[model samples]
Structure formats: structure tokens, C-alpha cells
Target: MKLIGLVRSIRALGEVAEQGSFSAAAGVLGLTQSAVSQHIAALERETGLRLVDRGTRPMALTEAGHVLVRHGRTINARLEAAEQELAEIAGHRAGRLRFGSFPTALTTFVPAALGRLRTEHPTIVLTVVDDHMQGLVPRLTDGGLDLAVVYDHEALPAATTGPLRRVHLFDDPYRVILPARHRLARRRTALSLADLADEDWVGGHSGSAWFRIVRHACRAAGFDPRIQLSSDDYRAVQAFVAAGLGVALIPGLGLVSPTAGVEVRRLRAGAPVRRISVAHLDDEGQPPGVRAMIAILVDVTSHLRRAEPRRS
Candidate 1:
């Protein structure tokens, strides 16, 4: 039987016992008298017993009715508890959020968002996975993650299709990181990628969006970068650049706490810009916990953007 059928049957039985008449119970349940009578009849047919003593003026329950009414009370209590638990989850006071993020996000914005989530919803458990967009999107599609913090560096809006819903957070600009002694290192203002054509580079490892973005941008600038090393970790990338292995591109989010060895400067207009965003299955029928996590993420990113000093 459907769950709603059972719940309504139990509700009808309990109301009839409390109110002492089908009409009164129907009024109490906001159902028609015929509907209340039909529910009792259905329950009686299911249990193969007479539930009401029809001979009485104000109806009294039969032995079978009394027994079923007792079970109805227990079911009512359980249903109330379940409703309260759902309410807590809806309020973001309890439940879990399975979140996925890439490395730079893990190091920067993700942690900040997690901190805010903890403060606002201390009872909410979080399961975090670190993976690139290629790996994370599939997991999200398969229902493995409640949300994924992904970035689009190709200067295009996130695709809107299937179960995926993309919420654009911010445009994270990429910057040039080079050793202190490098030529053009003193150029704190916007610098062209073509200027680094003859420069060896430190790009991110394969299997990451950053790696592909760097490669594509350099090729667009009319030269293929001779990468000495590829490290997804920005700190390590900075370390390689500091040792004069090569210049590297680091996102502005990663520049929150710069490494000591390199001079971080803005890339010229039309440089690679990453759109940091949160992607999740369409939330139309999702649980409250998923919506709660998304709300917290939006709030955290908003505050960070407001607090940050805009650069030229």
C-alpha cells in the first residue's frame, strides 16, 4: 500500500477514536464524512475485521478497532518525530552535505566556505572530496556529491543541461608568477602572455583544468610554453618559478596568501579568467541539506568578494 494511504488510514482511525463519531472525526481531519468512513472501511477490509460498533449512537470501537487504534497512536508518534527531524534538516540545523572541490578551491575558497558552514550549521556533517572538474562532474551526475565547486577558465558560461545546475560565483583572474630577478617581473601592471613566449613555464599537471587552460592560452599567444615542471599545487608552482625553473600562471584565489619566492602580477586584458562556480543536480526536488549547503556557499563567496580589494 502507498505510504500516504497508510498514514491517512491511521489518522482517520485515531481521529474517530478521539472524536467519537465519523462526522466529528471528518471535521477534525478536514476530510469529508464519507471519506473518513471510507478510510475506516478500507482499513477494516485490509485487516479483515469490523473496526466500529455501528449499533452504538456515538460510535465505540470494536476489539479490533481498539487494537488498531493503539498501533495508530504509535505510528502517529513516529510520524511526528520524523516531521521534526525533517524540519531540523530544512532549517540547516542538522543533516549532511557531500561537497567536492578542486585543489586551489580546497586551499582557498572551499575552506573559507566550510568554516562559514560550520559556524552557521554546526550539526551539519560534511564529506569533502578533492578532484578536478573532469572527475567531479561525473560523480555529481551519479549522485555521489551534493555539490561540486568547479571553475571554468575557458571564458564561457557553464553548460546548463540534464540534472546539472550551475551557479556562477565569481570571475577568478589568473596572474603571472615569476622569480624576482626575471625580466618583466617588475611589471606589476597588466602584462601580455605573448611576452612569456620565450620564457620556460611551470604549468599544472595533466588531468586538471588549469593545465589545459595554460596550454591553450600559450598556444593562442603564438608560442608553446616549454614547461619545466607541472604542479597543481600553487605553492609548489611558485617554488618552481622562484628557483627560475619557469614562470607560472596562478589564479587570484590562490594569490590570497602568496608564496615568498615569486612576484605575482596581473595578466593583460583578455588573459585567462576562471569562472568559479558551484554545480549541483537540479535542486527542484532535492533534500533540504543540499539547498542549505548551496546557500552557505553563496553567502561565503559573496562576503569574500566584498572584503577583497579589487585590482586593475
Candidate 2:
């Protein structure tokens, strides 16, 4: 007999042993009386035993039937436990979530969102990693991560290809960071990119997306920025600007707590903006934990946007 049929037959036999009749077992198992009788007959044929005493008014299990029913009870119990576990996972009561995010986001709204998720779904196991967008995207596609928060500049949009989908979170606008003592820092109005064309620029590593966006924005202003120092760390970049090394462009999300001695100003025109998004695989349906995390992230970002200062 096929494995499926064998399992079903065993379950039907066990139900008949408990209920005392094929008709009663059919009602309990949600099968027709004929179907239950067929299952029992198939089980008896497979075992070469007369498992049921059909001469009795109510069914009675023979020695072989009693032994098989004992095993069937164990199988039914295990199947029930497995179904309960799956249901809990589907309902977000328990499961594992592998999540990822970029550095700035990790330091900003991501933590708050994660904290809320933990509070709401305490049984969910969370594993988080911080990496750049380039690193995060590949992990999402390869099934290494369940969800990730990533960003892309207007100048260079994210390549969200191949079984991945993204939901936009918010736009992180770029602000020019100048040394507190610098001439541009004293200006009351927003500074144009052209205003800093002749100044030395502090930026991200040479080949990074951040650096590329900076270069793109500078070129749009008709001048290539003279980047004198480079660092991936936003704090270090701000420190470079503070020490009068050069001016730099930092995103709003990256300036959670601005370091001392730097003046952050809005761009008068042509400011580069990073589009933040939460990405996941384009599966048939997202797991409940993943869906909950996405919702928390959106709420966190909404509160952050509202709390941000109106002025640059």
C-alpha cells in the first residue's frame, strides 16, 4: 500500500477502536462510513490479519488491531504536535526571523522596531546582521535572510532583481556638514553644491555607493569635488569635517546624534536623497513574524519622520 494510504488506514483503524463502530469513526474522522470500512479492510489485507471482530453488534479490535491502534495513537499524537507548531509559527506566536539592515538604520529606527516586535511576539527568535546595501541584497536573494532594511541613492538606484520585492520606508535627505568655524557654516540660508565646489570634500570610501552618489551630485553642480579624506564611518566623516579637513554630505538618518564642531545645513538645490526600503523574497506569502516586523518598521519610521525638526 502507498505510504499515505497506509497512514490514513492506521488512523481510521485507531478511530474505529476508540469509537466502537465504522460509522462513528467516519463521523469523527470526517470520512464516509464506506471510506472508513475500506481503510480498515486495506489495513487488514496489508497486515494479513483479521483485525476487527465484525460479528459483534459494536466493533471489537482483535489482538493485531489493538497493537496497530497503539502505534496509530502515537502517530496521531505526533501529527497533532507538528500541526500545532506550524499553526503557532503561522500565527506569529513562535518562529525564527533572520533579519538584516544597514549601519545607519541599525543605529536609528531599526532598534525601536525590533524592540516593539520582541515585546509583541516574545516567542519569536530574532537574528539580525548589519551590512551595506550591496551585502544585504545578495543575502535576501540567496535565502540567507528573511528580511532586510536597505537604501539607494537617487543617483544610483538599487538593483532589486530576481525574486525580491521592496517596500519604501522613507527618503533620507542629504545635508552638507561643514566645520563650525568654516565660512559656509555661518550662512543662514541653505548652501548650494556650487558653493562648496572649490572646497576639499570628506566622503565615503572611493568605490562605495555613498562616494559615487557624492561624486554624481558634485558633477551635477558642474564641478568634481576634491575629496581629501575618505571613511565609511559617518562619525569619522563628521569628525573630518569638524577638524576643518573638508566639507561632507551626510544623510539625515546617519546624523542621529551629530558630533560636536560640525554644522549641518540643507542643500539649496540638487541635494541627493537616499531612498530607504525594507526588502524580502517574493515568496507566496511572508511568514507572520516577517510581516509583523515590516509593520513595526513602517510605524517606527512614521514616528521618526514626525519627530524630526522642521528646520535643516
Q: List TM-scores for all candidates, in order.
A: 0.64, 0.68
lDDT of 2 by residue, 90-202 (tens): 78446768899999999988999999999999888899998987788777765667899987665654453234688878888789999999988889999899999999999
lDDT of 1 by residue, 1-312 (tens): 577797789789878888889999999999999999999999988888999987887888999898887776656644543564577757845566778998778887678778877877777777899986777876676566778888765522243122478887777878888898898887667788888888888987764677777777777888877887988878888888888889988878888888787888876654677777888877465655567777877877896566443543
Best by lDDT: 2
Best by TM-score: 2
Give the residue spans of candidate 1 off by over 4 A: 1-94, 155-163, 303-312
RMSD for each model, in Å, please? 16.5, 17.2
The residue-level lDDT of candidate 1 at 83 comes to 64
